[model samples]
Target: MKAKLRQLFRAVPDTWKTSATIRSLLFIVLGLLIYLPIMSDVLPKTFDLNVNTVSGVTLTAPVTVEDTEATEQARAKAVRDMRPVYARNDAVTVHQLKLVNFVFKKVTDLQGQTETTPDAKLKDLKESSPFALPGDTMPALLAMPAASLTAAAQETNKVVTAVMQKGIDQNVAREEIQQQVNQQLVLADLDSRTRKIVREIAIASIVPNVTIDEEATNALKETVRRSVKPTMIYKGEVLVEKGQYISEQVYHRLDAAGLLERNASYLPFFGLAMCAGFFVLFLAFYLSQAHRDVYWDNSKILLLSSIICLTIIVMKITSMGKGINFFLPGYAVPIALGSMLIAILLDTQLAVICSVLFAFISGIVFNYESLLPVDFRYVLYGFVTGVAGAYSLGKATKRTRILQAGFLVAIINVLTIVALYLLLSSSTGWRDVLNQSVFGILSGMLAAILAIGFLPLFEGIFGILSPMRLIELSNPNQPLMRRLLMETPGTYHHSMMVANLSEAACEAVGADGLLARVGAYYHDVGKMKRPHFFVENQINRDNPHDTLAPGLSKRIIIAHVEDGVKMLKEYNIPKQIIDFAQQHHGTTLLKFFYHKASQLSETPVSEEEYRYPGPKAQTRETAIVGICDSAEAAVRSLASPTPERIEQLVRRIIADRLEDGQFNECDLTMQELERVTKSICETLQGFFHNRIEYPDDKQVAVKQA
Candidate 1:
């Protein structure tokens, strides 16, 4: 049963490697997992309550929503408080002033009638007047002297113009205007009867000059209504206290907030779905554009999805205890764990993108008492911590470096949390600050511990060669490296030179330099099988190959490639390292052995038999290692090499390989190849530069004395 279960587990990765449908399903599952935490509040928890009832428990709004009834009431009140708008009609004032002047002119004309008696003139004046006067006032005006009459008429015009200029509304009574006119005429230089007549004429002439503007009044009320904001039932706001009476207002608030029993709305679900779908699509698009290898590989896609889901799960769990008589539990979420793991096991650029995605997801999961779907505080904290972890772990070559990265992440977390608290908090408290700081520190440390524990598992299951693992394999104390050192010291030393050349060249061309270095270290472990038969290991001894037939020599020389593959497999080294041992000597002709064999046989020798059995260099690193391997051996053959010879030799090897089509399998460009050539030449020149001779210690001491 155990063996069958192991088979079952092994079959899963094979399916993932071959199936595109499974890879797409993995992304779909990731989107659903992201939507899980926010699902809790999408459909709010409802309570049974009515007006005038006592509440059993305190209820907080699960989602933000508009209180429509309350908003309407607020708008109605705003309209009621707004004052009416009025407009003045200058045309009415002008007409009233003209009538006043005309009335006085008619009085003067009637007084100038020579043939009419005073009673007839008075009757004529009354007939011509625009308004009626008191029974005795018309006769008094006619009987007055011309100077007094003119004075009264001028005073009346002045009083009418003054009263009308002060915008009298239709609501103003005529009695008020009469009283104001009486006061203005009291200082007139005329008899009391003439003054009374002037006052009545002025009062009649001053019609109401202002009127209510219905359009203006309505517009003012509308402006006031629009200025009033909608009444909102914010998320996590308390609608009713424990054991408090559910008044009509509180009951309506609960109903509007969806806390009272009602049909659930699907709008929130649709909104969350859209958000999750958009995020997933964005992540997929980023990977396809920036890291196509990960996008095309099912195992890598699965690994990325798993890490994001696991981080989100941790965040969701942390958010469950949020606001449990505390400021926040979100500070304890190890959001950086996903970023650090991706940086160590995958691409650092991908890790950076994942950090931002994780931060946003955290905001959604921990959105407590927030007006927005995402809480910016948690977003800021998560982004800072996750990015710190990723950048700090980018160059980690040792296991303990993960812990050190964790400490750095902790420091960043503490600074971020404290800064956010101080910036956002209205009333800062020392105890809450201390608690949040502690949580942040612990969160970073916990992320590190978890990363350390999970790194090996991920590497083992997915067959990934992280920098840390490659560094571990490069150690001289490893079993294969130790065997190579003890059995063939000459080959080991030669391998080190090739490692330096390969690393420099690969780095110059934007390839994996560390992988190239590690691969170069074990590239020649096959030479240890028959140490003395190879040229490098044969010290102080006659050449064994000179005694043997050329064909026999060729067989022994080519056996190392096959022998290296067998031994590396038995030792369980990573396949990437083994590829170096296998493919570094691609299918180029072994011309030295082939020429010697052809000279002895008196016939043409088959070039295929003398060539290394190869699938060719399948990656830039392997191709670069192949070039460096040949270049190093060639330069070392010179008795005394110079910079010119080293440059010529490196370029020749690269040109020969390119002409032979050995680099056709990899995506190495000519520009990259040229860069590799330059880099290799510079490195070899440093290695083989001339050195000055030094005096012996005894001679130096004698000269000094």
Candidate 2:
């Protein structure tokens, strides 16, 4: 059943492939999926209650909106509360002081006039004064002695100068200025009449030296108004409880938010669509430029899209919960699950990119208040945990590694949660911290569990040869591996040696070393079908191939490729591994059989008949594997092999394959081939290094004597 399904997927038509039309449609569907969850928060929920009427149900804000009435009231209060600014005029103080001096100087001049009567002097004093004085007070100023009058004038100047310097504006009333003058006069040494006269003169002289600065006062009020933030009806915040009366303020907020009317604005939806479109375009651009292999393969693209959609859906579901106690349910969203799976089943670099995308999506999905376009707390948590998950699962070869990756993610999640709480929250308590930590741990563990459960399904459905699957196939206990080990131990040993050589060479040339190693492990599985015919497994037995005719031997030798391919297919192995078994020989001639047939037969033996069916190495991995397979066998056959001989033999094998057009299909460069040659030679030297020969006991005794 699985085999048939695999065949069906392989035979899918070009219409279903990643053409422009299909790609666009897939991206459109992904964008819609993203937009739908976001739209749920913005879509208005209307109420029927009027102001002063009781609400039937508790009404929570669907989206965050400004409470305009409350905001305006707050602004008005801020303006009222602000104190008016004032500016002082030095010229006003200077002129007022001059008038006070003139009044005192005139009083002195009247006292010194001998030609004038007391009435005349009083009249002169009154006429000369800058400000009005009482008729009774003027008579005392006219009769006063020069020294006493001079003290009064000096004291009046002191009082007026002190009061004027303190900046009296229009806000300061006449009575307040009189009270202030009286307080200063308490310390003056003037007689009652003289004090009264000085007080009247000083009060009149002290005009408002400070006036309101209209520009400065207006600017201060503006600053205060701007500082007062608008009152917001936060999303999910209760506007009115069930059976609660709807106040005028509440009604106005509801109406302003479009929750009291049917005609809601579609701008939120349009904005969300734009955001989703941007995310889709970014993903498309990234895949096209950085991971073209996944971009071109429609199946891989589908797999990636499915993972992203599933992860977002999980986050959305988790975010909908009202949180356990003080714990944020967003902490338990398992955001790292998608990244870990992508890292294991796809490219690690692509997984890192998806981690960032998931982080941003999580920010939007988990924004409970909808106050900000994205809640940065969730963004930070998602990014740190996702990156930790991806990096922790680096080249994972064991199923348990996923769990380990999850554990690491959990640790990071806990730290991230604690850090965010400490850094972003104003009043986080111990209970809240503990609850978030627990949820964070649960998120990591859940991500691991989900990734583990989904891995096999993805590999089977999409025929993805993940590192874990490759390692599983490489295990000695696997059925095919066991059969090779027991039935043809010699071939199994040769396969292991080739695996080591190929893995090193492939890695040296920046190819998939794990894939190459796993491929080499199963490359010679067909030899188990005719163990004795192969010289390696013919221990203590006759070489069956030596007894058969050249044509028959050629058929047996060539049959392994077909037989290995058939066995691998029956076992439902991935096509990549199967390619290794099929393409390792790459139509290379069986020289011994072809030469034998040429020498014995009257008719010339055709080279094509002796060669394996040709579909030469079609990838760098296959090409490197084939080269190492030949080099390992050839080097093992050499007697007393040296480093120089090994290097010479490895270079010759690569040169022959290059000249014979075996590597023509693959994109292996001359520089890379040289690296492969060096790597193989180095690996073979390690395998066949000279060892110390210890002397026997009798020889050692003879030498000692």
Candidate 3:
């Protein structure tokens, strides 16, 4: 039965197994699995209660969690315990004393006015005193003799000054102050008339000298808030005891704690899955429309999917274990590291797309425990920093460029963290701000370090021709490249010229110029095996083909492609470079050997035997390199090549390839071929330009002993 199952699974076709759509489907299913568990509490919950409700079943905490309501209540109590703030108004007491002196002077002047009637003088004194008193009290003030009135005024001023010095506050009412004044007046040694007048003056002089200070009060409340620690409900604690009534408040607490029966809704799970699907579908659409090459290739799809999954897995791991997140938040997951790797290994545009998609994924994955399930602050931080990493490492051809990009990404991450952190909470402490900023910077550097570590693995396993890999292959110190130079020095020089021509042409046609250049460097690696078999390495000025039969010469010439393929496979070179070695000659016939054999043989020769086994050039870069290889050899054999001759040679080479249908498999257009011809001709002209002749004595001479 196990064998049958193994056979059944193996029966699937290789094409289906390597399908990008299947990989995307698997990725979507994995995303749904990751989201479902975290989304349990996010699902909608409805309680079965009108006003009062009884518990249908007992509830218990599934995990240790904080009771938010109770914590808020405790904080509120802490704030309430704080005392109200008050500030003493020294100016109030001084101003009230000054008013008392002014009023007593006015009263004394009225008592001594000789020309005015007592009734008129009493009216004037009442209005000038600025004190609230009965009309009868003002009239009675005239009955006291000047000597008694002066004593009363003096006593009232003394008592008012003393009372005002004690700091009367707004909390004490006017009636209470008046009662205290009346008691003090009764204790004074005076008759009823003088005591009553003094009591009235003393009461009016009293005013509030202390008032509520709003800023100080708010500052105290803030201090209390900051001191209140988080309150939590322990794991497995009793949420509701047996036979306990489920009131509205109790039901809400259970619901908020994710323990209520109504919290089991699956709608949110479905919605979250759909949201994830939307992002995946959007990425698929983007790849299909914008980068058809990446979308169609299964290896690239697998790599992309693997990178996204790896990044998210890392994010999930770093964000695990609740309390530890204070040092490293969800935004510190190093998403930009993945983006930089993708940009270096793949396309920059694809890296940007991955950045946006991962941002959304990060927001959802990290916000599981938050009240709001999607925290867009993390999304913004991840997207901006990831894009910065990708864009900063635009054409990363060296390993150290990744480090440079990491520092740039860290700066952007820190900036984004500061902006979002301040926006979310203006009152955040400098210590917390500094902590999050450190995490942001560390996230960027960690991402770069991880990318550097994992880059070789992806390149080797996938056989990707990244810019760095191409640069490495182009180095003259490489084993194969060095062997080619030592064994076939003439072919090595020819390859360099071809590389220069191909690189210029490919750039003009908007193809992979680096790929073309590197491919040209290794195109003739097979010549290293039998260096003297080809004409270029024949240093003795003797043609080996002259001594051999035409059939043998043709066979020797045609065998280089096969030998090169074997050497490339043995050395584990990427297929992209090997394509140039195999397809550089295409299926074109060796005309010289074929005609020579037909002239010597009794029977006509078959063209198929002299032709190269080829799949043709399968890309624009490969096609251009093949054309340049033939053009450079032909141009070098010219008697006196000038601008016109070089142009004609290049045009003829391209025209021959077009006539022979060598470019049929690739997507090289007629217009692009014209552009390549122009660029190659201009470069060749400059490479073979004339040099100035110097006088024999003026030029530095070397003796060849």
Candidates' TM-scores? 0.68, 0.75, 0.68
Candidate 2: segments with Cα more than 4 A from true spot: 1-8, 11-30, 42-58, 73-229, 240-251, 260-263, 546-549, 599-601, 636-648, 688-705
- What tens-digit string does per-residue lDDT give for candidate 1 at 165-201? 8889878887888778877777778777677778877
**Model 2 lDDT per residue over 191-287, tens place:** 8878887898888888898887899999999899999999988877777789988888778877876787655677877887887899889988989
Instruction: Find the 10 residues in a row with the least total lDDT in model 2.
Output: 320-329
In order, what lDDT does every prediction score? 0.85, 0.86, 0.78
Residue 370: error of model 3 in Å? Answer: 3.9
Model 2 residue 264 distance off true place after TM-score fit, in angstroms: 2.0
* Residue runs of model 1 more than 4 Å from their true location after superposition: 1-26, 45-262, 427-430, 541-556, 600-604, 642-644, 690-705
Error of 1 at 206 (Å): 28
TM match of model 3 to true structure: 0.68
- Backbone clash pairs for candidate 3 read none
lDDT of 3 by residue, 604-688 (tens): 7899888888978889988988888888888888888899999998898888889999989999999999999999999989987
